[model samples]
Target: MGADRGRRGGRPVRVGVYVGCGALLLAGCASMPDSGGLSGVESTPRQDAQVRVFAKSPSKDASPAEIVQGFLEALTSDDPQYETAREYLTSSASQAWDPYRSTTVLAEGPNAEAVHSGTSEGTAEILYRLSGSKVATVDTQHAYAPDSGSYSRTVHLTRQKTTKEWRIDGLPQGVVMGRTDFQRNYKSVNKYYFASNVSSETGGQLETVADPVYVRKQVDPMTQMVRALLKGPTRWLDRVVGSSFPTGTELKKGVKSLSPDDRNMVTVPLNQKADHVGQGQCSKMAAQLLFTFKDLTPTGVDEVELQKSDGSQLCVLTEDQADGIASHGTAHYPDYQYFIDGKQRLVRMPSSGSDKQPEPVPGALGDGDKKLRAAAVSRDESSAAGVSTDGTSLYVGSLVSGGSLGEAVLHSQGKTADDRLTTPSWDGQGDLWVADRDPKNPRLLLLQKGAGSPLVVETPSLDGRIKAVRVAADGVRIALIVEKDGKSSLQIGRIERGTKSGEPPTVSILELRSVAPQLEEVTAMSWAGDSRLVVIGREQGGVQQMRYVQVDGSTPVGTAPSALTGVKEIAASEDERLPLVAHSQEDGIVRLSSGEQWQKVVKDGTAPVYPG
Candidate 1:
């Protein structure tokens, strides 16, 4: 029998009967002999399992409007090939369409309607009204850039006589996904780039900075991200950074794809032209790839192998080896808190555990009766800029003991002290920035370290006044708090270096972008991290609070830690790990508590500051 077949069986038995003594009567008795009944069994058959799969395809009788909607909706799916989405388009359209060209992120579902434009019944048009802000756009080069505003698009459709169904005969080149779908289908990743030069303050270490960009999570993100890195930094960052990839360089033709093998090793084939490059340069290029793809799912690529077009290995780098070739600088903060002490003298609060009392900094500004109101220390901690108590003169001098206090570098233009200069801020380049809020000649000023005169930085015409100005570590961006019509706003402006060279290097404000639009009144703000700011503001008719917001005017998700009440002035380092220090109305100067609450760190201190 076959292995699947069951066995058939039967049972047998014996019987006893009476003798045939009586021949005639025994004939009936012999028939009465006992007998056992017969028994048997049969085999049963097995059934095979059935399975079903669903294919998302265009409907045979879909209308022109439906075809357009279906194509847009299909974009949110995990089908990276977008085969089903192609079903809604004609063969020619399908072949010409390039979904990777760009992505228009809409606020919500698009409103699409069919419009009979021409006399022919085979042709139709669908007008899509895309409401809400266009938060961002990903270009063909895969550079994600922030854009703001609203817009509309029109998608043309056609019908086929044989199928009697509508298809997208003409449409936009790129895909459009709703915000919800965008969040699900795309991920934000940072590509590393080196600063143009080594930091003057830190001996000679390469400064690696992260440039955040978005990529399709399900697509061949490794390839896409590498291509973007090879394209160099975005336009905004071009002037401030450098890349390892040589100019006019790109991956070899016919070698467009990249993927990790079973061992999590990714091989990148470049053009034969790159074969002439040296090993050190090749290692830098490989390091860029390793860092860019470090956060990918299913285990990141552990090692990267770079190859020439001929398939010869140019260089191979493991993650550990890459780390040794590139590194980022640590956050630079002053060792002590510099502020005005109770005696109206420039003093330093011990940041470490060794000191028991506040000590005055060395300098005539700290020893003499100069009566300083505000002070700022340079990133190198070698020099200091101080404002007078009367707010009439701004002085600059050495922080060392017995150092001469220079003549006033800036003077108040206003008659009253209220319109004088606010706190001064120092940029990484050693230039000092301050805003002269003097109503008479209100403007921003930039002073070169040893320059005799200060360069005037133009400010945008506003109904309100410029209260505070803070320069970022990059030295190319500035944050301003403007008060207009009894309301305050947090604004970020790019510092445009003047083309005409002068003693102080002429500078001006090109434009300003709002950061915290929802805040009714902004009290204070400091650069907490790269591309992020810690702001203390109050909502319209609400209490005062502090929160973290992106420099692009987007609020970060999740509620912020407990708000610091009665905060008069706040200061923070570029490092987010550093605790926030603030001068409160009730407790003087304080830092964040272990539980993220505000606790007093010092008494009788004001206008605390840290290096930018």
Candidate 2:
């Protein structure tokens, strides 16, 4: 819903105010419309088809090379213990090998070949060249990090002499699976953790953060996910977030598994050392597991029982009880879409009933001569930011009618109009982010609401020019469309917050990783959900199209919404349930009500945008 006029006038104005050409020179960069949903559009359900997991086993009388090949194939099976795969290895080798230590995800297709290199016939050293693109790596800690390079391994084999069959005597410790198998057998799941010492207005409640990691679908996923939670956040996020499980905490000896009971309850037995933790701390720990396992199955985990090694109960928590202790900032969004109407005025589309006409947002910018090329709304919908039509000036003002349209907050330093600022994005913290594409003085800038000077963010690894930028609703990550060497690609990077004590909180960009590597050119993009993005791009020599991809550079399963023709810009909400809205050259403002087709909702609107 649009911001209520009565409340907007009462809020304090914190951003810097400027005027005319001087203000235009202060705006950072340019970005296309990252607009969201339209009203009265029916939402479509995502496909729920279960992935097929093929089973493979070692051949009884196969040669050493065939046995090795079969073992590698068996690694992709759904067997939790990998019982069938162990048959191809010797007793000692099987005991030493740990399949869960790490998973090396290789490219699609068969790029593995086994060649004998030993002098003797009975005892041979087989070198397997497992060469392919290394897309990602998943460790035992359940952290999914991007990786690239080549890989190879050698396995020692010898005939048993008694059974006259060859067996693997030496092999690597971890498992390696082809891309196709990895996609089918493994799935990504986000584990929730809380910020250290950060409390909400309700008091004693901590804010929850989602850490996405991959786990085996058929393996003991419930246990694996919990263990990952116990291991804590990855290295990159350790400095910023905290966990309920203290250091040195671990599972009790002789307790090798965890599973839900007939009553849909999971009993977690930690070492006796956890007894020192207070009841409040224990409840927080249970809250993390409850949310982590929320989507594990259709029924989901109803409750979690924490106990000591001696079976002494420490604490018990249900889904309802955990909700009271942990807080995920408002997932609910407003009920209307905001965009620039054909008349260059800010307009609102009622996101519910049959009234399809959009009403101008109440403010000076809504009816004035300040022609805007693009605009963005804050997450709270209290303020609005816009760039002039000629891309020379940037303005920040209130959404209410009586509120003042402040002097230009930023102006473009670029020589040409193409070098001006792009569309601006607001995070949950009320900070606005935008990029300056001027080839001479290209830089990323951050504006704090009600603060005077803007902070210039660092982008050390940015080799090319920034075409557009979109920040996630969580305020931790950003999506970028970068052009280098005449080719455009989609990239994602983390927004590291400056933590130096006694200084204002500043921001910097870490190294960026490519997301849609298959697309040669990315024209427009937007955040579709927490970890996924909807991009408008195409492969080399291919026509423009839109598809959904994960921020980790992995292609998700299920068919994407049907492609639209002449689509110039696209927008989507942080909530996935809302329908997607876009501007098409041929059809004007179009909405994707169902995944199969596009429906035109407005015939005259352009540069559509939604509140963050």
Candidate 3:
């Protein structure tokens, strides 16, 4: 659903199911190579010595006028040589288009006439008109058939400017096929060309002619525009990745010498530095996106940031109210601020739009509403952790208002104005998945809003606390990180079609021992693919790190220390290899698309806000 592309832009109209009933007309249009500008009539002419002489036969030796007459005669006289009409056309005209694929020369009137004139370019133009009993053929192999309707066609013939020889250039410009009314007795020239590949059932469509070539002409500009638009929510980035970050901030900033594959840690010289308020006690980790404001210079948007653990410097700076930061409570308004602890938190920025009530679709919730209520009562938030993609309504988590640990399902889309889930993650499909901790059980319960039943998936081990849960594709798999025993572990599970609960449909647990040991709790979890996961934050070393782990067996497959020095926040690009890192020294965004080709898109010290 997220990958859907836009169709043609125009006024919507109800089209009939069947559209092949209209009469097909013989109209002419032209296809020419991209030609350079033509000179004035007085420009020197280049001689064309390649013209072929006609044979002595009466039909072959006919002049341009006679040749046009013969073409008209064959259409109405039913002459046997009609099939061999090619014998009379000039070699240039015959080679211009594939007769088998070109005009079928259907029916023409016996009174058809050809008018010829010479142009300044030394080409003779021909206009042919006919009506009644003209010869026509559907395809090359088919015999000419008699037809009744009268029709007209205009053709262009170019003579070698120097030799005064003529040849056909086919259709003229004004008659090409396009949108027009069918009721009128007008003939529109239409051109159709097709190519196919066996690898796919359908072939891609490409226009033979496109106006304003600018659309496809500049590749670099288009690439930059697309990259900028896809730079997701910016406000959230600033929240998570702050200005002054620690040395090991997973997302780092680099200078002109940055590489393509360096994921974490960027280096910057003081002279060309970003606006850094010096290093903070917290570990800064950020994923920086090279961006440009609509009216400003190039900048980078940090999507995720891991601030230092110490309390000296504030990791997030935003207009969001400060109180919401301490209690994990709802923001007073649309934007708010807060601090992040050791737990891994995935924060997505809110989109641009007015504050409208969430709308609820009756069937969208399925029969799970009741189950959600029963299950939410056991958890504790007053507001549901998830909502539909439409934003029409909101779902209350099992845990709300510090209330009793029982299952409860509350709707906030229209009724409640205050409490709403913070940092919600969507499954790419329509369903939203949220994380809720169970007081009695040490496991984290995943509250799903769109499933048939109010759904919940708990971590296998009750010893660890669940911090984050991410869904892949359309609810196919759920990836989460659990912090237990001062260590963080990654968990993967699949959703079963009919199951209600207990040991989720299919589950696998992987502990993050390699990255951190004592306080090695996971800080962030991002899914690069179904089998791959990227985790940020540190454990024992006090140094922030970005680890790429394969979920198949719960182990680390690769690790990249952000070359970015003094990192603040780390955000991963859609491509797993390229990680954007923010630096603390100067307000800068370093892109690690590779280990060698590092480019700084934003050098401003503006820190992005993450879900605190």
Q: Report the number of the highest-TM-score candidate.
A: 2
Cα lDDT, model 3, residue 106? 24
Superposed on all Cα atoms, the candidates' RMSDs to the truth, in angstroms, are 18.9, 16.4, 27.9
Q: How many residue pairs clash in model 2? A: 23
- lDDT (10s digit) by residue, model 2, range 1-612: 000001111232111111112223334213423354222111111212232233345547877656655566567656667777788888998999988888887664234456656647655455554445676778767666667777666667777767877888887778876666676677888777775422242355566666778888756678788778888886655655778877877787777789889898999999877877899999999998988887556566899999987889999999888878865533536567777778887777865424577787778667756888788888778888888888878888888877778788888888888898988888766778888888888878889872367788888888798888888765667788999998999998777776578987667778688989889989888887666788999899999989998777776665787878877788887667677888898988777754447777778877777786
Q: Which model is ahead, 2 or 3, in terms of TM-score?
A: 2
**Model 1 whole-model lDDT (C-alpha atoms):** 0.68
Model 3: per-residue lDDT, tens digit, 1-612?
Answer: 000011111212111111011122212112322355322111112212221111122232345544443343222211222333444345665564353331223221223245656455434555543323222222221111222244345655455455454444453211111011100111111111111100111122111100000001111222222222222212211221122222233222331222112432222222112234333222121111111111011222222222232312323322121111211111112221111111111112221222232122112122233211111111111122333332223343322223322232423232222122223444422345554433343222333433334344434433555556565432344566665665676565543333346744422232222212222556665554323456666666667666665433223223454444455544332223333433334435444444544445345422222221
TM-score of each: 0.73, 0.83, 0.28
TM-score leaderboard ranking: 2, 1, 3
Give the number of the best model, judged by lDDT: 2
Superposition TM-score, candidate 1 onto the true structure: 0.73
User: How does each model score on lDDT?
Assistant: 0.68, 0.72, 0.30
lDDT for 169 in candidate 1 is 72
Off by over 4 Å in 3: 1-422, 438-453, 458-462, 497-519, 553-561, 564-570, 577-592, 595-612
Q: Against the correct fold, how does model 2 do in TM-score?
A: 0.83
